[model samples]
Target: MSTNFTYFADMSRKGIFSGHIQAMVYDRSKPFNSLPLLPPTGIEEDVDILKKLVSSSRALASVDGKVQRLPNPSMLVNTISLQEAKASSEIENIFTTEDELYKAVSDTIQEGQASPSTKEVLRYRESLWEGYRRIQEKGTIDLDGIVAIFSKIKNTSGGIRPPHSLTVIRRGQSEFRAGEIIYTPPRGPGIVEHLMANLLDYLSDKVDPNTDPLLKMCISHYQFEAIHPFPDGNGRSGRILNLLYLVNKGLLNHPILYLSKYIIVHKDDYYHHLAGVTQAGKWKPWILYILDAVEQTAKLTNQLITNILEQMESTLEHGRETIKWYTKEINELLFSQPYLKPKLVGDRLKIASRTTLNKYFSELQAAGMLAQIKDGREVFYINRDLVKILEG
Candidate 1:
């Protein structure tokens, strides 16, 4: 049976309204503890599109398995993680070049000298790893844990915004009207607390499980965003939750899916779909939007894994045939950080001579495996193919 999800209105405190003396109110408080009536969990949604989505995600799972089988998964992991960080941050208008980001996080470089955009991206990646580790250790994402995730990303002590803060989601800044109030989130400490408690319940699977985990994730995500728990960092934190939720449900073995890349690509439609549910009680379109995101991203991810494996093998095979100093360890080391320096690889391989280091990398450059990059007085080798794959 189809059900209507109407937005509930909440009265605002006196003087809380936006400009022009209109009483400010929040009308998007659709709770998540209950009342998101999904279609029957099974055969009802088994349309051709759903079937294709299942096939696409299943194919992603298969490729994810193959990526793990590679001689070194760290190579792909580092590349994908940074790319995800870059793409996710870009959605927020924080921009940085790939070279700058890679150089910013480089162990040899000084962190203080990195551009603001680069530093933000590095923080996003670091926070993601922290969240992944937290989930792996605790096996649960509690309120405190979510706060900590935001803290790490924002580089501050992050917690839900209090009622006194007066955070309103607005568009365009105009002195006359304080911009248009797109939506005013729930206020009051007690109300926010209750909603968060319900969120924890949903995340823990303590609620009903009739809906598929994927669909539930979509609902949970909408709830979190609507809750708008934090004054800032809600978007990024919510995204981190997306990946963690997938992991919690065992949809992914590792946090390797670059789902943000897909979202950033469809940025406008992404927000529009979310807004549809908020304003018009449209659920099917939003759910299908996320399903397609996962499906398309999965297909893209699977192809990338294949490309990485093939490139790594090709590089290793070339080394085996031509280079006298070729070793699997050396090959993996290069892929591990597509930007290679002589001192770095030399330290790893115990080669004390500059000539030997240059020879090894130069041969690969000649083979089109690497391109010699000059950074001021120092020369570095860029794994051109890996860079392209990761950047794209």
Candidate 2:
């Protein structure tokens, strides 16, 4: 059925933002088919498309350890690379429900999300941990593990898998239609489940595990998203799948390259490219996008790591006089985890005394090499200057 789509506006009179529109679907039996309530004029520039390309390219280049001039001479290549990075990172960073959701995801993925939080937090934590475990033990992809992991996130226990009736709304102010699928995931009763098992086997064994890791990752990501196997948490599942896929393929030593940031920023384009392939028989854009994200994220992540190392080196060099071996050791440790406690310091550095660890931490803080977090209990030592550089 044909649907009319329009945009919305904010209080400030700014045009309806992309990804922020309300859509109503009229049944074919009714007089109207659909109407997309849209906002007014969006921000425009003489060089909007190019400007977007520029921003995306700059972001992409920045991720890959290169900070290009704001407006570059090589518009064509930059635009291409920007699209690539934008596609990949969008897939990498799936948005959570809120700040709590973000922390839950961050903690679950980076650390472990085990403390008291929402049901979503618990599920995300369990799912992420399960993915990590599968990577560690089998170095193989496991659909059942993924299903079970998401089952926990959905707060359903004693089920073979999540039910297909679950619904989700991806767009703001847009409700789901009866026939339209906001997020109707696949059912794993028998036929669908069997297909999934086979798909995983093919992904695991289609090629020699030791070869063309990046290409393997791309193929696996496409295959998993196509399968759309779970009733809930598919987006999160897909993201985790990408990282674990890389780890199993040995592309990344750890799940540190959270490409989600890139994706989250270019979320609209990301879904567009994915839908383009599904609806318009397009694949190159998606593939190139994935490749660009990988290359850019890897380079950007590597740069972050390098910057952290360099900052550590410089800090240690400058503070060598006042700081002890424990100080340097703690600095390196903090670089690895970004957040730590005095207990972790004592345990990691083999400092038998908490007082000694605290002493070292205090001296480092005084030296402006470390800072505490919002949490009162945890005083996280940070390389402020390096942190700023990475954040920028």
- The best candidate by TM-score is 1
lDDT of each structure?
Answer: 0.71, 0.48
| TM per prediction | 0.83, 0.61
Model 1 per-residue lDDT tens digits across residues 1-38: 01111112222222221112121222633222222222
Model 1, residue 61: displacement in angstroms? Answer: 2.2
The candidate maximizing lDDT is: 1
Global CA lDDT computed for model 2: 0.48
> Once superposed on the true structure, which residue ranges of model 1 sit more than 4 Å away at CA?
1-53, 172-178, 350-368, 377-379
TM-score of model 1 (CA atoms): 0.83
Worst 10 residues of 2 by lDDT: 31-40
Q: Model 1: which residue pairs collide? A: 17-24
Look at candidate 1 and tell me the lDDT of residue 79.
73
* Residue 42, model 2: Cα distance from true site in angstroms: 39
